[model samples]
Target: MPFENICIFGAGALGGTIAAKLAASGNVDATISVVARGAHLDAIRRSGISLFEAGADKPLLANVTATNDPTELPPQDLIITGLKGHQLAPAAEGLAHLLKPSTRVVMILNGIPWWYFHRDESNHAELQFEELDPGGKLWRLIGPERVIGCVAIQGAEVSDPGQIRLSNKGRFILGEPSGDISADLREIEALLNRAEISVTLSERIRDDIWSKLMGNASFNPISALTRSRMSDLMADGATSDQIGKVMKEVKAVGEALGANVGISVEERLEQASQVGPIKTSMLQDLLAGKPLEITPLVGMIVALGRLTAVPTPVSETILALVSQLDRENCRTA
Candidate 1:
């Protein structure tokens, strides 16, 4: 499939950026959509999706069919969701409109997805992750088979309505949950690659996903809780030491769950230290007064530890702090 009809939910940052790039490419017979709400939707419908590269002020404009209601849109071959891991539940009912016979909803979120255990040989296989899935609504409403696994390495977010601040590379790792590379996935790979986004087809996407999680399990909450950027947290010897402790716990959980993450905690900590002064998505969400992704990024990992009979004292410590931040922020507001 060349994506003749495409609908990207949450035209916020990453989704809008990807929509703009797809429009720039002269392929796929092109009926592009950016599903958003409120001022963002109004602006995109009136003008267009404004895309910023490398968080620059000057943004590139691309004409996109932007709407808030999914029902009004045409049935699509693919529905790419750029929503945070927690927001999937609230939007599930609305998302049904985008589902057709062959539509695959690709989730671009950090942390372990709800469907992580589906079809795996591990004892945790088919076990629902309550942290990510909440009331089991997402796993039931959307169905695991319809979810194409995605891990976004690209850093981007909505600077404003109809505008997105994007990083240089997309580097989105894509894979089937069962670890099979299908022709459909190759088609998406071709489309995104043509748009200048570096796409990798993961044979063991779960490993790559959890590897990325090594950083998020440490930095995201630390950023949200401490209000520090990536460099500030990771570069300091003391913070790096704390991160190393967290990584060790995360690796134990991963191993107990049967996903062998082949990297030392020191290496992961050093890698984060070198990423410069980037702000995490959790920090960004906190700044914007939006709901934090505390559940999926941190809570789910700890939940995995419990499921697999692993200990996560460090992860639990951070998760408790971040959850308190979320609760206090919500309460005061």
Candidate 2:
């Protein structure tokens, strides 16, 4: 089940990094096409994607098929989304053009995904979060059966339109929501590993999602509201303590829903502090006048907390402030 026709949709920062790596590797024999827009698409079409890795003497150029129109591409074997949680629904219609009956969509998103409860074994099975997928568009169009959940542990940013700056080389955790180790999952994992991209297969991807969300649900909004970098937030005792409280609340909610976070608040904070002075994506988007990812990152947590009857007073407070802040930013933008 080799994926010959692969597409990277919304090739921004993280998506661009994955696309560049796959195209440059020359190990995975597949046609890597990118669906992007604006100056980034133009530059990629002109000179391919330029990847500036940390401590690299020169940039790595990955030549691939670049286009903004999904309709132009043929049916794909795999479509790895690089868009944020908030960006997926709007592109669902265009994305469908690349899907066939067997196409597997790798959702590399932050926070809770739209298919979170799709095949759940619990009472919340098939529950939809409007905050994450307003109007059930993604659920209806993309189909959860086609979803392969992924948590990207890497940090990257579009330094320029066609240039992606790699902050760190991190691995990806991928799995099926049904907790099955299907052949499709293995094939996709092998494909990614062949491209020199590190990947870990998980049987329980929901736990992995919740583990990652513990930090994202806490750090992203806090960073946006305070306009502080990871190091700065972890440096101040007061701010660090506040972040811990929020993380604990998020943890409590996840635990209520049978998710094991596997790490303590102190350990998570220490890990984040080691990342130096990198700004969270939410903070970056706010500074750049883009729509904040409040719904998936923060709003969903509060919603889930209520669903599980967990007291998330701290998360609720932060959600309120950030939601309004996002509104102001959107209005101005």
Candidate 3:
């Protein structure tokens, strides 16, 4: 059955755009709502969510119910979290009340998710990063079985409070942690496809997660540090060399976890360079004074390397620098 009540939690740039697309699809058969705060929430409540895709003259609109309080809302059949990795913790307690027994949570964020190591067969449960989730709050609250992995490859940002501008085109890869396809997964695929958004189901979601993380963990921090675009990062031999080294370390970490990324460093760099002068989400966040999503994008890779006895010196250095920069930004905020 199609999901009935849906909530797009953390209705920021990517979240708002996805919500708008699904709600405006006219075939989803779901009541779409969004949990957002501040001016964005007010704007969405007033005028719905606005999206301007590439090459669009005007904007696409989707009238979704917007709220800051999830407790007052009905239980959701599906909860799509669009928050950054660092923003998940504070919102977890509130979201716990919104989940019914059969509710599914699709986390569409970049980097290593909090549930990455939940059901691994290895004896590395002790290696779970407390920094990502202190006291395993999200894992215990939401339960890994209800969690679905999503690798979102699109670049989007909020031009204003209620406006989302999506640049380029990309696809979403969704899968269960156990590498099995289920009815709900197929339903999600159908919903996104109907909206004219690309979606795919993966047998091994972790491999795809690592595949995207390899690039995110490599380019995002370097872009923030250098204040450079993707083209600039790829053009400089030294900068691109650092990205390649970091990606190699990430590949080793993924392999140690039994998920091969299956792509060469050169190929990844070439593909990224072709994206032109696009600014990474990390760099955008830094410039906007928002909290840098360093933990999952960069820190988790470093932590996983430590667990697997692989060295990630390049990523580690980038993590330390970007983290300090984030701390300084927060200090003045």
Q: State each model's CA lDDT, in order.
A: 0.81, 0.89, 0.87
What candidate 2 gets wrong by more than 4 Å, as runs, is none
Supply candidate 1's per-residue lDDT for 104.
84
Using alpha carbons, what is the TM-score of model 3?
0.96
Most TM-score-accurate candidate: 2
Q: Please give, for residues 156-256, the per-residue lDDT of candidate 2 as tens digits.
A: 87888899887887889999999999999999988888888889999988888888888898889999999999999889889889899988988888888
When sorted by TM-score, best at the front, the candidate numbers are 2, 3, 1
Clashing pairs in 2: none
Q: Write the per-residue lDDT of candidate 3 for residues 1-333, one digit (tens) a residue.
A: 558899989999888988999899977888899999999999999999889998688999889999999997899999999999999888888789889999999998788888887666566643456888888888779887888899988888888889988887767889988777998899888877987889889988888989998899988999998889999999999989999999999999989988879898889988988888788998888888888999888888888898889999888889999999889987886
Is 2 or 3 the stronger prediction by TM-score?
Answer: 2
TM-score of each predicted structure versus truth: 0.94, 0.97, 0.96
Q: Which is the leading candidate under lDDT?
A: 2
The digit string of per-residue lDDT tens for model 1 on 37-73 reads 8888898888898788874677777898877788889
Clash-forming residue pairs, model 1? none
- Model 1 CA lDDT for position 297: 79
Candidate 1 or 3, higher lDDT?
3
Location of the lowest summed lDDT over 10 successive residues in candidate 3 = 120-129
Report how far residue 21 has shifted in candidate 3, in Å.
0.9
RMSD of 3: 1.4
